[model samples]
Target: MTTSVDHDVSPDSSRRPPTEMVQLKHPGRVIGAVFALLLAFLLFRSFLTNENYEWEVVGEYLFNEQIMLGLGRTLILTAVAMTVGILFGIVLATCRLSENKVISLAAGAYLWFFRGTPLLIQLVFWYNLSALYPHLGISLPFGGPELWGGETNKILDLWFVALLGLSLNESAYMAEIVRGGLLAVPRQQTEAAKALGMSSWLTFRRIVLPQALRVIVPPTGNQVIGMLKHSSLVSVIALPELLYSAQLIYSQSFQTIPLLIVVALWYLLCTTVLSMIQSRIERYYGRGSHPTTPTKKSLRQRLRTRNEEVAK
Candidate 1:
């Protein structure tokens, strides 16, 4: 006996031609071309101007040992200050989030005082610390030995005071950035970790912080760039950073605009480099979370295909 078998097929199961390809946007190409032309035109016009800016002057200052040294110092100061500031910021954020009233209150007061005051005033305050207090020494809260001793003026004379002031001032803003990042983390994440028997510290380190870093890094990068530029302010106290070095050169040659141009170029270079770094960091942190283009196959289908391949 011959048996007739019935087959069922859905018309929609048939594959259709790939949808018309969407054109990739080239916004950057247009912007870049326009900007490049504008820059070239400006440079050509500057060269033809009667002021006759000496390109040699720019080259000389650019390669000058004093200027280079000052640039190096500025970079170092920025790096050190940002590092310390971020660390202090983490501490402050933790304190602000603490269950203890005293800790939270102290953190709030610190943030308020630093954020309320001007950075320039803070710098001047550090520079003139000796005037405020003649002697500097570590005193115990209860009854311990005075472990440290130094004259305030002598200590302030060193770069230490400037570093301290910059770090402290920056910490206020950094604290806010950190707190925002921490708050951005979902409370359910903490609860889930706790449900899994993870301790608070472990949960924070492994789960919350890693996710919060995505939110924190962007603003933190901005703060770092700001710190680099703000290092110029220390020049008022004879820090001899890039801006001050330029000032010294212009004072001698009286080519104020040219000297200022050199400074501006260096700042542009630094900020540009920093912005590239920020982009890379953001991309790295965005890996899995970024919206991906969906393919025809669902995730389960993809996984089944992989499993089949493994079986083969």
Candidate 2:
């Protein structure tokens, strides 16, 4: 007698779920649509109620040379402040993580003072620095020649006060961001670098910082955008930034709402553009570690492969 072969298959094998047909819902899209509708309705009502709500007036003020110049100044201040803030933040965060008690204490004190107080108060304080100290000067610890030059009243200058206050305030928050990023880096990374005979600086520069950048960049971008808007607060000191310029225009034209709208629109535009840039940067950094698709290929290589497949 000959043995017979049986080909039995499980039922589940033939009844696999269709993942390709699965539908996913996005709540964000719905919420955004609703918010857009509400905003449009409010804008329409404002236009109808205000006989002086001329779109041309808004455009004119927006494009005015003086306003544009003020906008440029605002951008410059934001860039300078953020740059200085992040630099100082790195130092403060590193100090906080240091073994030295003095450095840690100093860093803690800075964060405590800045974060505890309102930014507005800091601005005013900086604007009136001359009142606190009649003659300001910088010198070496052992009392050498002055570092450069200083004038107490000079601090009250709009740009000087804006820069000083913004940089100092931003540094506190940046310290937090840097600390978080540093903490996100696994302890094992530092240990491994040390095991390989790397110096602390080398380990941080080569291994830790590169990884931490992914975590830090998004928040840093947010801070940059916030700084841009916060620069408007310097208008209190008569800085001719976008908002101040708008105020001057409205003061003359008596178009408060319209001028205010122009300022809001500019802020919206700047924030939107910055957000787009942030998204691109985040996407770039996230590409390799993306959960949806994990691959070791370089971005250019991946693009090339896709192009080849499409051509085929």
| lDDT (tens digit, per residue) of candidate 1 on 28-112 | 9999999999999998897767465776678778778888888999999999999999999999998999999999999999999
Q: Report the C-alpha displacement of residue 13, candidate 1, in angstroms.
A: 22
Q: After superposition, how far is residue 139 of candidate 1 from its true place, in Å?
A: 4.3
Q: Could you report the Cα RMSD, in angstroms, for every candidate shown?
A: 7.3, 6.8
**Span of ten consecutive residues with least summed lDDT in model 1:** 14-23
lDDT of 2 by residue, 67-180 (tens): 888889989999999999999999889998989999899999999999999899999998887887877878888878887666778645777788999999999999999999
- Report the CA-based lDDT of candidate 1 relative to the real structure: 0.87
The count of backbone overlaps in candidate 1 is 0
lDDT of each: 0.87, 0.87
Return the TM-score for candidate 1, rounded to 2 decimals.
0.79
Clashes in model 2: which pairs? none
- Model 2 lDDT-worst window of ten: 14-23
Give residue 194's error in model 1 in angstroms: 1.0
